[model samples]
Target: MISSEYCRLMARYSTWQNTSLVNAADGLTNSDRWKDRGAFFQSIAATLNHIYWADALMLERLKGNGRPEETIKHSLASPSNWDDFKVLRTQRNEEIEEWAARLVDADLNGTVVWYPGDGSTRMERPTALCAVELFNHESHHRGQVHAMLTAAGAEPEPTDLSLVP
Candidate 1:
C-alpha cells in the first residue's frame, strides 16, 4: 500500500511542476501554445487541458463524488481559452493539495469503486493503486507538454522530483 506521505509528496510535486509549466506557457503567444507539435494531444494547450480533465475526473472518483455526465474525451476539451485554462489549472492544483493533506493511511487501503467513463461498466481497484495511477498519469502527460513547450521555445523549469521544494 502507498503511504500517506508518498501521496502528499506527489501532490506537492505535481503542484510545483504544474505551476512551472503554466508560467512558462504564459510567456508564449497563443499561436505558439496552440501549435500542433505532433504529440498525442497534438498541441501544448490540448495536452494541458487533458491533464486538468484527468485530474478532476480522478479526484472525483477518489472522493466518491460520482462521475460527471461528460465523457473523458469531451472533458478534455475544457478550459478552451488560454486565460481560463490558467485559472482552472491553478484551482485544481490547490484542490489536489488540500485533498492530499487530508488523506490518511486507511484512506488508501480499501478498494475504490468507480465508473471508468465507458458506459455502465464499473471498475474497482485499491485506493493506493488508483492514487499512484493519477499521479503517474500527470507525469506522463506533463512530459509531453514539457517537450512541446521546449519545441516552442518556452523553457519550463526542471521537473526532477528530488528538486521539488
Candidate 2:
C-alpha cells in the first residue's frame, strides 16, 4: 500500500509533466500538433487527449460508483478542441490535485476495477496501484508526445521528476 503523501506527490508530478508537455506542443502549428507521426495516439494532441480520457475514466472508477463501461465509451481522436482542450485540461488538473490532496490511507488501500485499453476484461487491484498506473499511463503517452514534439523541433521541458513544482 502506498501512503497518501506519496500519491499526492505523484499527482502533482503528473500535473507538472502534462502542463510542460502541452506548453511544448503549443510552440507548434495546429497541423503539426495534430499530425500523426505513427506514434501511439498518432499526434501530440491525440496523445494528450487519450491521456485525459483515460485519467478521467480511472478517476471515476477510483472515486465514483461508476464502472469503466459506464464512463467514456470512446477515445477522443484529439484534444477537445484547439481552445477547449486547454480549459478541459485545466479542469482535469484541478480535479486531480483535489483528489490527491484529499486522498486518505484507506483510499489507497482500497481497490479499483476497470477494463484495460485492450477491453479484454475487467480487472481489480489496490486503488493505490491503479493510481500509480494512472500517473504512469500519462507519463507513457507523454513520452510519445515529447518525442513527436522534439521531432517537430519543439523543445519540451525537462522531464525530471525532481523538477516538479
Candidate 3:
C-alpha cells in the first residue's frame, strides 16, 4: 500500500515537472507551439489539450467526481478559452497536491471500481495503484508533448524521474 507521504511526494514531483515543461513550451511562439507535426493530436496545442483533458478526467475519477461531457478531446468545452486553460491547469495541479496530502495508507489499500474507458462496464483495483496510474498517465503524455516540442525545434528539459530534485 502507498503511504500518504509517498502520494504527496508524487504530487510535488508532478507539479514541478509540469511547471517546468510548460515554461519551456512557453518560450515558443504561439504558431510554433500550435504547429502540426503529424502526431496523434497533430499540434502542440492539441497535444497539450489532450494531456489537460486526460489529467482532468483522471482527477475527477480519482476524486469520485463526475466525468466531463467531452471525454478526452483535443479541445475542452469548459477550459476552451486559452486563459481558462491556464487557470484550470494551475488549479488542477493544486488540487492534485491537496489530494495527495489528504491520502492515507488505508485509502491506498481500498479498492476503486471504475470503467477504463466509455461504456457501462466496471473494473476494480487497489486505489493506490489507480492513483499511481493517474500520475503515470500524466507523465506518459507529457513525454509525448516533450518529444513533439523537441521535434518542432523547441528544446524541452530532460524528463528523467531521477532528475527530480
* Top candidate, metric lDDT: 1
Winner on TM-score between 2 and 3 is: 2
Q: What order do you get sorting by TM-score, best first? A: 1, 2, 3
What's model 3's overall lDDT? 0.73
| TM-scores of the candidates in the order shown | 0.93, 0.88, 0.82
Q: How much lDDT does each candidate structure score?
A: 0.87, 0.80, 0.73
lDDT of 3 by residue, 112-163 (tens): 6656546467776677888888788888778778888777677777777677
TM-score of 3: 0.82
Candidate 1, 25: how far from true, in Å? 0.7
Please provide, for model 1 over 1-165, each residue's C-alpha lDDT reduced to its tens digit, 9 standing for 90 to 100: 688899999999999999999999999989888888999989898899889988988887788755543544565656768898988999999999998999998999888777665648878888889899989999999999998888888899999999999
Higher lDDT: candidate 2 or 3? 2
Model 1: worst 10 consecutive residues (lDDT sum):
65-74
Task: Flag clash pairs in model 3.
Answer: none
Residue pair clashes in candidate 1? none
Greater-TM-score candidate between 1 and 2: 1
Which candidate has the top score in TM-score?
1
Candidate 1 shows a clash count of 0
